[model samples]
Target: MQNSATIASDFAELPATASRGPLRIEYRWINDAAADTRADTRIAVFLHEGLGSIAMWRDWPQALCERLGMRGLVYSRPGYGLSTPRAHGVKWPVDFMAHQACDVLPALLDALDIDMPARQRTWLIGHSDGGSIALLYAARHAGALAGAVTIAPHVFVEDISVQSIAQTKQLYETTDLRNKLGRYHADVDSAFYGWNDIWLNPAFRQWSIVGELAAIREPLLAIQGHDDNYGTMAQIDTIAQHVPHARLVKLDACGHSPHRDVPDKLNDAIAAFIASQT
Candidate 1:
């Protein structure tokens, strides 16, 4: 486990356009150190949390890419990071995560010229809400990916998640949380409120992805922290039950964000998993 986190690297955004929507999206590219010397390695796509952005991933993605000799693409969703913000007063629906996986991500990938079945298929590494999106995408587009790694993914909404989010909402309003998060997002309010409202909405309590996970045929690695405030072991347990080929890792003293809390262990586990699959 790492004692401290690395500083986030500065990232530049390239506008990615697609027909499904998100006229413009934000993305960054990290070339492998040996790109000039070796053939391209597999592509690793890093999807941030509901409230996360490309910058929030800090140096973690680059570190992982360096270890595996893989090329990396880290991007911010429409309402986070330097990406486009959500329209005013628009609350994400219960199926919002689904939309992100099934529509938004594919379009963004296309815009980036990452065509599947032609060029190298990408591997997905997602955190928190991003993890859930990864699952959905793998389920829907199993043939398009090499594998997936989900850190602190949610298969279903839990009371603990709702409660913790409520606390974050309070903190955002009362503390410096907003000011701090603002540094990572273009529109901090849009990023925070967009994620917070949907999770807290009464209708969202029944949202679940357990049924959809069975369709995913790609090898998957589900990781979670034992002390994660937002979810429990049941999340990954359910994933294992649904995706028979899935692997699970539970870390002690780690929180919701394993990439941040136990980076060394998380990176090692991820590298091993990817190696086993490749």
Candidate 2:
């Protein structure tokens, strides 16, 4: 396999056939390596957190892809980055994450012409809300993925999560959180309000994907921080209980984001796990 020198960036507009009306996605191709190696390579698709966008991931995805000598596809979900924003006054439903996994993500891959079942099955690396989306996708389309890695994923909404979200709403209104977040998003309001409004919705409190976990037949690596304020060890533990071959890792001194808090350890663990699987 030829190893390239740098990452490449591109965008794809979903076609009418994808059923996702006029959506444009911003994506990055990291560690392109070489054209000759494309056929045999397994691509890692990185999905960002709730408020995260392509730029928000910064250099982490590229760093990991380089470490593994793997190519990676990192994209911003609609409404999060330079991608299409949610229409004004529109609200996401309780099963928004499912919609993302089953519809948006598939449409994106299709738009990019990356066939998942045609010897191009991907390795999904997702964080927080993205992690939950990864789990849903793996369960619904088991054969499309080689494996899944979730960091700080939430299978069920917790009271602490709600409380933290409430505080974030306050920060958005009172502090400079909006301005700070604006650097990473094209439409700051669309990203923050869309995520904040949904989680804080009363009906969302009952949202749970516990039943869906059992259907995830692919190997899983569930990582979470012992000190995470948004979720607890139960999140990863429950996943392990259902996914027979699942592995769990709890990082000490790391809060919600192990990638950011302890990237070296996180990358080592992920690279080793992916290598073992292959």
Pick the TM-score winner. 2
Off by over 4 Å in 1: 1-22, 118-120
| Cα RMSD of predicted structure 2 | 2.8
* Model 1 lDDT per residue over 60-155, tens place: 888888887887888888889877788768889899998889878877787776776523357899999999999999998868898899999999
TM-score of 2: 0.94
Ten-residue region with minimum lDDT total, candidate 1: 1-10
Per-model TM against the reference: 0.91, 0.94
- Residue 75 in candidate 1 has what lDDT? 85
> On a 0 to 1 TM-score scale, where does candidate 1 land against the true structure?
0.91
Total clashing residue pairs per candidate?
0, 1
